[model samples]
Target: MAGIDNIMAAIPGGSTRRFYGTAHWDGARWWAKLGDGPNNLLDAWWQDPVQPLQGGKIAVDITKDEYGQAASFVIGGYTDQPRPSSGTVQEIIPAGVATQIVIMGEDAVAYTTDRFIGEYSPGDPVYLTWDAAKPTVIGKIGASAPPPTPDAPVLVPTNPPGSETLIATASDTYWAPGGWGSYSTSRNGGEDIYTGTWYGNTVTGAWFYGAQRPALQGKTISRIRFRLPARIRGAGNYNDIAIVHFYAHTSGARPGGDVARVTGPHDIPVPPGFAGGDVDLPLSFAPALVAGGGISIAGNPYTGFNSRLKDANSGRLIIDWSS
Candidate 1:
């Protein structure tokens, strides 16, 4: 009992457009009849007959128009029995059953059922039967499609953390008389000699440098020490009292205007040259180290005595700080 599936007819150029019908094989030939509708009542018979042998089958593909009306049909080949409904195994469960599948007639919709009869992987073509209440997977059809290719990985860069540090050092000896803007009569000793003059109440002169000078730029003077060789003019008199004062200036030169008095106006008693030792003065309140422009040092001799700062291996200003 072989037969063609359901068929529908289309009327060209007519409002009574389409109608459903059926076709069957009557042992020796194919026969068809349209439904009893207006302009659709007709019987059709295959012009070329098909005579099936004792145990044989046939396959066919029918073409349809845009209106889903039969336009033409082709007999593909012959087989043993009617072809069973088949699908591709979309997903398989642990129980060796296909839970999701795509069928010939319902390819767009994934049909869910416990139908698979054997262990199967996804994408394996399958033969199935849905005649019973639940669908059943009767057998495998063919090999599955290949798995999709994967993409490559990407690379990125990472940076390390940052930190802070403090740099400190002792600077070289910076001289005075050379950086000083104004001065009185002074002599230069190649190594060791007494140069500046002495007067009553005014022993030595003032020496200063201008503001924003390059040597002191972006630096603070943390400690300042001066090496001075001193001696009294008369051999017998040791009462040559002199006060050495260090000052940081803002504007004008020496003894006037905005002045930051640093180091000391401390007294130093000048002994006879044979007994005179080094004068070590540690300066304080050196605000000019950060704020003002330059610094200076002057001498104040007490009333009746005359003192002088000898120049030889002395009068070197040493500064230490962190920039």
Candidate 2:
């Protein structure tokens, strides 16, 4: 028997519009009264009452037997809000009572809504556009890993007889000499002659340069050639003697573990009339050049013999190889 004013005062936000009161059982069923103020409408609801109350709008909880169903109605509440235009799938609930999904968009804002458009896993790109006045999911773009590339055979050009491709070349200078020890210069014979003396020790008389040939990496070295104006100097019969030794290193300083070696003095003596000529020695030892490594060449005179290698402007060490 609670009056309208008493019911409005008993509930939250008393005397406000749509002010509802606590529910109770009037012996037969559950009943809740609401106040609509003076000159406004009165409201009442019941779960299992047979008679209607006087002077009020009556509403009943019709879904009393349905499990997990909401029994009350709200005027300005929404079950799901509008999502953004574009986002990425953050999570998905496929087999739950409420099948829904979560997405993340700009400013890292997250939104959870029922999956209405398509099936999506996590990290799937989604685009939503307004269609017929409703936000509808239009497309899903997924990023998959690319396929691996297969190894192909390297194409090598066929050169004519006695022709070769120059992989790398290094020259010598009298001023720097470039790691060549026991170096001496003689200008007494009207021409400047450079000499790198070898004393059987591997540390002395060698020249090295950077051997990072990107084009020659992983390629088979078919042949190697050396071109240097050299001679057996001093008062000894050192004809047809091995004077220079070529090597390869993985890193740092000359003569560091010979990865490949090529000997000089191929039984052909120095040219007549000329002081020294190009000692052309073609080597047939084919070694596969390892990646990230370098090449080096050092003078290794036969035991006790002392030799001289001269570079007057146009001297070079050449490497000929196949791809």
Candidate 3:
């Protein structure tokens, strides 16, 4: 038989009891053997709304069962749900933030132990949320930021009236792939590509490059390449990075029928530190925009090397930037 370690904190007047454990209170039927006795008076059975109360608090109802060992309320929010008040903050759970109650005084003749304190205003209401990852407390209450006033107008982008066309400019400077750019290069090493903005005089066009494999379904242009430098680490390391050429059709659209071939302008160098030393490379072929629904970008397989690494403080990165 399993050992028993439960000690009940009965209400002054009512028979409702609360049990404590190393982790939490299990139901009396299941929490019979807690091992450790009630260590503090704050440990008691209570049922409070899971939502965070702004200025008010609610009462907790505690009572004893027929056989009366000790029992506590359990719900999704009690262990799973997040506190409603976690607005813009990542909404992390606070340590030692248990849902148990502290018994201040019990009303002996009332037949109901005053489970909790704090008054609830008529205005405040409870909210609901979910946590499939784990069990949580229910009815976590939180406050939403008040609407901003006109003087404190919330900033939002506004489209100009009747403006249909957009224009963008191409910079000369080389930019790292997937990195932001506005820089100009000296000899056009196939490094910088950007979305052209539409001006009254000029209609800026988008840049596209790389192998246009129409037969390969789901094959997409990785990005609008202003430039794609070769793998210039030394001799034989360069593979002639692709460049942007001219568009087949005039209007910028998807699944573009026109394709551009390799246009000259090759260089070989390093972009600082690879296996050591500078790495410089040049663009091989010109790039062109793709249109229609047939193109798609491919994803890379993730390595768990980052998973095994821990933060300096020894914390694990469960949810990554991409995750």
Top candidate when judged by TM-score against the true structure: 2
* Counted clashes in each candidate structure: 5, 0, 60
**Residue range 244-285, candidate 3, lDDT tens digits:** 222222222212222222232232222211122212222122
Of 1 and 2, which scores higher on lDDT? 2
Quote each prediction's TM-score: 0.27, 0.28, 0.16
Give the Cα-based TM-score of candidate 2 against the true structure. 0.28
- The residue-by-residue lDDT of candidate 2 on 248-296, one tens digit each, is 3343223423333333323432321123433444443223223333333
lDDT ranking from best to worst? Answer: 2, 1, 3
For model 3, what is the alpha-carbon lDDT of residue 202? Answer: 16
Order of models, best TM-score first: 2, 1, 3
- Residues 1-323 of candidate 1: C-alpha lDDT, one tens digit per residue: 11223333322321222233444444665433333333432333221334323222233323343444443322222433344477666665544544544444234445666545766677767777753223577777774667655664554434222221111111111124342222222323121221123342123232233343344444555565544444434312222223335444343243333244544454443322224344444445244533432333444332111122233333344555544
- Flag regions of model 2 displaced more than 4 Å: 1-204, 235-315
- In angstroms, give how far residue 279 of model 1 lies from its true place: 4.4
- Model 3 Cα RMSD, Å? 24.9
- Local distance difference test scores for all models: 0.38, 0.39, 0.24
For model 1, where is the 10-residue window of minimal lDDT? 165-174
True-structure lDDT of candidate 3: 0.24
